[model samples]
Target: MSISKKTWLLIIAFFCVYVFWGSTFLWNKMAVKELPPFFLASIRFTSAGLLVFAISIATRKSLAITRKQLLNCTLAGFLFLAYGNGVFVWALKWVDTGFASLLASLQPLIILLMMRVIQRKKLQWKSMVGVTLGIIGMYLLVSQKDIISKEGMVIGILMILSCLIAWCSGSLFVAKADLPKNFFVATAYQMIAAGVILVIASLCFQEPWKSPLVWQDNTQIAIICLILFGSIAAFTSFNYLLKHVSPEKVTTSSFVNPVIAILLGWYFLEESISLQTGIAALLLLTGVYFINSRKRDKPVVVAKTKV
Candidate 1:
């Protein structure tokens, strides 16, 4: 039997999230090589935001929202995009894209720990074990003498860690915050807010801005891919999958994205992958699996990371 139109759409949507979102690490790394990170991010998000609005209007999604919702959207945007994603792109300048992706995959572990501390929720046995494995994995990943000895490695790692915090915190906040009923509208507002703030940040940091026309060909392609596929297509697909499929199935992207990043980095960028890093990937991903598996029965608020 032939596949239904909806089934075809689902397959395409999954492809977008898996490959588009996964390859974003490489794209960001490539772009940041030629462009100032904050300035690059400002342009990417600003252009994507405008495009998202245009799409929303074409689709006739309501653009209306209360003041409180707008404020919450702004806050979410600041936490998730301005700090979380902007600094993440900046850190890419120093860190290998594969390693950066692995570190970002720790969002579930971070969120769980945050829940334990902020909500005082006792961890179940599976969760406790998952947390333990996650910690070990993180230590192994970071404790590699060869990797950490490089100039600016420590700062890159620290900045990425901070991004995780901001992203996880944003996830927690959005779970409770009053926002526009339409996710697309809220996301549009958040993107615009993040774009504006990143522009100010680029200025405050004295990051010399260059016109897109003058950017290197590869950098231009990278930025275009980030705006079109990474930000817009992947995000739209993610929301689509969440609505049509189980959340757990959609979350499988967390595992797939890093693997894709690692492979792409190795093949295209020639990024090294050591024995320790391999082991760490195994442990960390397994831990994330356990955490997610355990949470299926007794659900808690979980927010996905965009990077």
Candidate 2:
């Protein structure tokens, strides 16, 4: 059967988001060793945001917006980037990359609960089942002997959970808010706002300059990769995918990211992948599949406009 061009585009967009975002955990791990977490995030987002903003202007993309839209974007930036990603970076100091990814994958479940509570959306049975499976999987993943002995594991887990919750809240808020019709412009605003907030926070809380500027060759390479692929490519593709796909489909990134993170951890960091981690991965993947596999009676259409 021949798929429509829109379908093909959607598929490609999804592939970009899934694969690029999945590898972000590895890049982040590499960056945090040499760069202070918030400082690194601030730099990554600021660089990407400026690049995209310049492109938008050059291309004559609509940067004009109402005060309400600006406010919404700013709030989302604080929630999603400053707090969500900021907490994620902080958590990595203690959590293994695989474990951090697994914990972060709980965003979908958090989104479900948030929707039910705030929007009065009814809870679906599949979501409940997915949440249960995910929780079980997290238990299996974190209870490993090697991971449990870490001094700050509990704090890391809490921070990661907070990250997931903050991200979900930001996502839901953005979904409901009146924002730019152009995804790229909206994303640029969000990133810029986030970068500003994160930079300020980093300067005040982290005092990143006081830390030795020792950049190992590997760390420098990792920083470059993180800024390019993790910040610019991954996030831009993600926002692009959202323009073409359903929110449910977009959430699949969370599911894919964990599996990629686990594999990368094994390959790059020489982290041990126990049977429990494998089982947890399987359960999480299964849950995500079931959650996203529901049939859509209507075809999704994409506008031919460029962001």
The TM-score of candidate 1 is 0.97
Clashes of each: 0, 0
TM-score of each: 0.97, 0.86
lDDT of 2 by residue, 1-307 (tens): 9999888877777766677677777877887877788887787778878888998999999899899999999998888888888768877877788877777665655666676788776646776687788778777877787777889998888888877777777766775689999888998898899999998998888545433256777666776776667666666666677666576667667567777888898899987777787898888776665555544343121111010
Q: Give the whole-model CA lDDT for all candidates, comma-separated.
A: 0.90, 0.73
Candidate 1 per-residue lDDT, tens place, 1-307, comes to 9999999999999999999989999999999999998999999889999999999999999999888998898899989998999999999989999999999989899998998899888888889888999999999999999999999999999999999999999998998899988888889999999999999999999999898889999999999999999999999898898889988788888889999999999999999999999999999999888887785554543443756
Query: RMSD in angstroms, candidate 1?
Result: 1.2
In the order shown, what is each candidate's alpha-carbon RMSD?
A: 1.2, 4.5
lDDT of 1 at 177: 93
**Residue 38 in model 1: shift from native, Å?**
0.8
